[model samples]
Target: MSRTPYTSATSQSAKMRKDESFLGRLGGTLGRKKKSKEVSELHEEGKKAINAPMLPPGTDIHPEDTLLEENAERIMLDPTSRENPKFKDMLKVLIDWINSELEEDRIIVKDLEEDCYDGQVLQKLFEKLSGRKLNVAEVTQSEIGQKQKLQTVLEAVNELLRPHGWSIEWSVDSIHSKNLVAIVYLLVALAMHFQAPTRLPEHVSVQVVLVKKREGILQTALVTKELTSTTEMMMGRLERDAFDTLLDHAPDKLNVVKTSLITFVNKHLNKLNLEVTELESQFADGVYLILLMGLLEDYFVPLYSFFLTPESFEQKVHNVAFAFELMQDAGLKKPKARPEGSL
Candidate 1:
């Protein structure tokens, strides 16, 4: 057979192309694997971090606390605004107070029996939220009188919060993850609610929820705090409480909401000259909730921030949407809208 003679330049070019194709495919596979590994590593890190021992409530561990403030400062420092200095000063004081109080919590629970204070469920939840697991044995009930201890700690917490225009409330559940979860929710809630109103600038309302899961679980604590403009707080409370009360008493709050919806529809009914379709009626109350939520965040919060500085409006709005989406995504069922004219 005649040897296929290729020009030297042509042969080299073909070889180079083959090598390049092989390397490219290999690099592509490697790149994909690297990305997959990175994602897996992040998931693992998140799980580990959530399970990490909770730093004492008032204080933080490592450089995280300082870093948070430093980052906050950088983001918030506006030379033209007088409120920036005030906000930074407030943040420093608040962080210090939290650290001190958390230290005290550790001391109070130090002598309690580990078994009695064992709150695995509460611990898990706390770990998820704060990236720290509290030492329940170090903060158990037998070590301190329940009511008195709670009162004292709450007083200190209130003191820490008062200057910042925040408030704390405590509740106990005898059944589930008792005090452990309650405290966790309280801290989380407080952090969320601690802010100046954007819309109702003069008024600031911070509300935190403290739940111990089911009733009678004294060993577990759960707390949740949400901060909003006073106007939003009032409106939210009116909205939330209506639902809560309705749930507490069967078929009651629904009547009220129905009445409200009907009244609303009646006023607009003739104007729109529209009959309520089944689909329209089903979404009526939900649409109202969406509107109310939007109004509270917009007209109320922005006005509140007008007095303090408009820094928190974007964050607060983003947080509300995030919270709503989170609940929705987590399988929390949305309330069904009652048919219009049902009232």
Candidate 2:
């Protein structure tokens, strides 16, 4: 084949085209880099907008949902098994955080369905607010993230323990978690206290009540001692009124609840004349303590039948009659048959 004469101009034009192609590739790469940088800047601006001044704490957070709403939603959205290692690790860390802060030992997320558990948003917010890609290690143990969580937990725990003269010293590694066995042990501890002897005070003016807080958190208070639950429970107007009446009666030493409690006992026991009015008339606290102690035996015997047997109301009262010393059952008094209800 006869070849056409190749010109220097053609050679130069081809070379120029090759150079242009190289320059075009370089410009494309630069354009992509510029786009990525712009995206990052916009993301930062979005974060700043989100972090703008907001409602104060205890401000009614969005229609009463958990703090962990998004994390859980993400998990549910992820199509990963609950047993997935990454998901489990997430859960494990979260559970540790929650059980530690709440002072409970529930091992699974299902257990928290009843309470305020909104960690997902808070967690994702951390990544967004930080503008950092968090790896598993960072997500679980990032000092900044954990510190934020710790501050929140400290505030809640301090709030929980304030009335009880208890406080949690905040730290990354806190002792809020209880091994499953330890949880069982606490119940045993409570049992031991009941079975153990008591240095029954001459009288006691203590009370405990279960209550639900404004944030759907449940707690208990010393009802007779503090009457703090009216606000803490965030009770409705009428409920507060009723609580006011109930609380009003308790601290005034005219405990109608216990008075009616005595009447209920007398009716059931078929014992002669177990009078509550007599106890109320004198406003005797020591006798009231003994009476309530008697009532506890009836209340508890259903569960602790092995230790406390069902007995007549009179008999129950007699059971708690003697002083129980920690070292030994001291001053064991005989059951006195009261023709009249002195206590």
Candidate 3:
């Protein structure tokens, strides 16, 4: 009877190791899944808090008009400098004014509709830059003229940027998820342009396409105020016209931005390799836009604090802004909020 004593150190050890590995992997997978689910749940909560466009059948015309100024306060309280020195400060001012008064955008959404406005602007600017004729929607002010679209879907994009205002939107499509996807398409095109500058290179240029963008002050403040349209005021012309009128007389808060922008640009031009003569509007659109994008970046913090909004939109805005900011000749992150005592 040959009975060999079983070795506890060999087979048993291997089985124990296998179980550990499997459990470890299982824990890791479960951990990642939980994090992702938590993030998604938080995102949906934020959207539910402040999310929109044309009135849907179940649309709440007046679903809690109370928006917190916490976002503004947070930025204002922080004396520390962001990317640009005045970035956070200016954002505080813009958010402050937007909440304090509500003339054009009575129903101010804390979400990221400003991206739609920017997309429209970018579409027009690209056409001009590419030496193509401005599209009908880009050139015409009259909504009636805009009625005739670009013939076919293949002819041009026919996007319905809802949560869009009745106002003639001329903003940077910096942050909204819908606009972020749109901006990604635009960035691919922009990258193509930059990789070649004038034309695509025959060989690899080794250009880096950085996904993260550095945001400034104004882009954060570029909130969309979808004017509640009624049967009596359904005319697009009238709606846009009213918006234009609102712009004619700048609120004291916005006026400060114009002044500050000039001073900031004038001082920073030499560093930018742009001479005083080259600082005019037409030539300096690149610089101005980069700076404006920064403003929005700055404004985003305060804006997010208001609704517990997700940082995804702000990150995308920063990504695109960084892309634009780097384009003078040629020349852009967020944290989640937790309770005071939370670990």
Candidate 4:
């Protein structure tokens, strides 16, 4: 101020720096005090919130265990409120639903052994030893051939059906969905013939039948009947011996029937390669027709019966009682041999 030699811009900068440092130090001290007070207040609020329930005027629930108790209760009560059905019955329904929706899927299994099903070795024996190749295709084409194939599949199916005192037969209506309808029909028939528990829902029925038939084209139909009703209260599970016996007695009729059909078709086609005949293609068509028929008999129709009414499920307990009076019938006959023993 007293003629200070007129300070340059650099000197002014240095003075300003010293003043700014002093102000910064003072501001820092005040800021720290304010932050400490704010932190203590927040800590007090948190402690109050946590202990509020235990305090003079807080919620009744204890703060310490609230979260843990809530999680445990949720875990315990959740499943009971949902899906109330017997495990077996639920599984059956699910399987039936899947089978119904997936009706269009055609299942085919192959085997080369002649005796794999229905004494196929014997069939081959007849072919090889008969001098003339057995014209399976020709035999399968005509109405007679179709019937014969049906009979063959039936025989294989009976290998399973008979031991449990179950029987299988074609429906009179010639329905559609050979696989689906047939299974339903089989179930119905078993229910009708046996004294077993109503394994199938009372309103449930399966119908697999022929909707239409053309030489090379066949239309099939499959349907399941279901109704809601009070489930019949039953006792303990059937004896393990009885259940196992049923399964063991008739293990793989469906598998046998399916394999037989494939072999029959393959054999016929192979025969066609060796020699030409007017009826070769026609026979091939017949084989195909029979294949479908066998499928209906084996997989489509019989499955319903096995699931709906089987010996181990106590479906055939009385054999002459409950089912007969309450159900519509289908398969009822036993295997019969012709008087002359014609093959």
Q: Number of the top candidate by lDDT?
A: 1
Report lDDT (Cα) of residue 343, candidate 3.
10
Query: Stretches of candidate 3 above 4 Å error?
Result: 1-9, 52-343
The candidate scoring highest on TM-score is: 2
User: Which tens-of-lDDT digit does each residue in 1-343 have in candidate 4?
Assistant: 5455556766898999999998899899989999999998998677556544333221132232233322121011112211334423533543443333223443121221111122222233223322234334433435555545444544444453466544344331121112223333443333332213224443332222212223322222333233223323111111234334546787666456545655665554453352223332432212232323334344232333322323342333222222222222325332121111110
Candidate 1, residues 78-97, lDDT tens digits: the string is: 12221344333433433443
Model 4 regions lying over 4 Å from their true place: 1-142, 167-183, 187-343
Off by over 4 Å in 2: 1-16, 25-29, 32-343
lDDT of 1 at 154: 45
Ranking by TM-score: 2, 1, 4, 3
Clashing pairs in 2: 66-118, 67-118, 67-119, 68-117, 68-118, 68-119, 71-120
Model 2: how far is 256 from its true place, Å? 13
| Candidate 1 C-alpha error for residue 140, in Å | 36
**Against the unseen true structure, what C-alpha lDDT does each candidate score?**
0.37, 0.35, 0.33, 0.35
- Per-residue lDDT, model 1, residue 81, is 27
Error of 3 at 110 (Å): 38
- How many clashes in each structure? 55, 7, 29, 20
CA displacement after TM-score superposition, residue 324 of candidate 1 (Å): 14
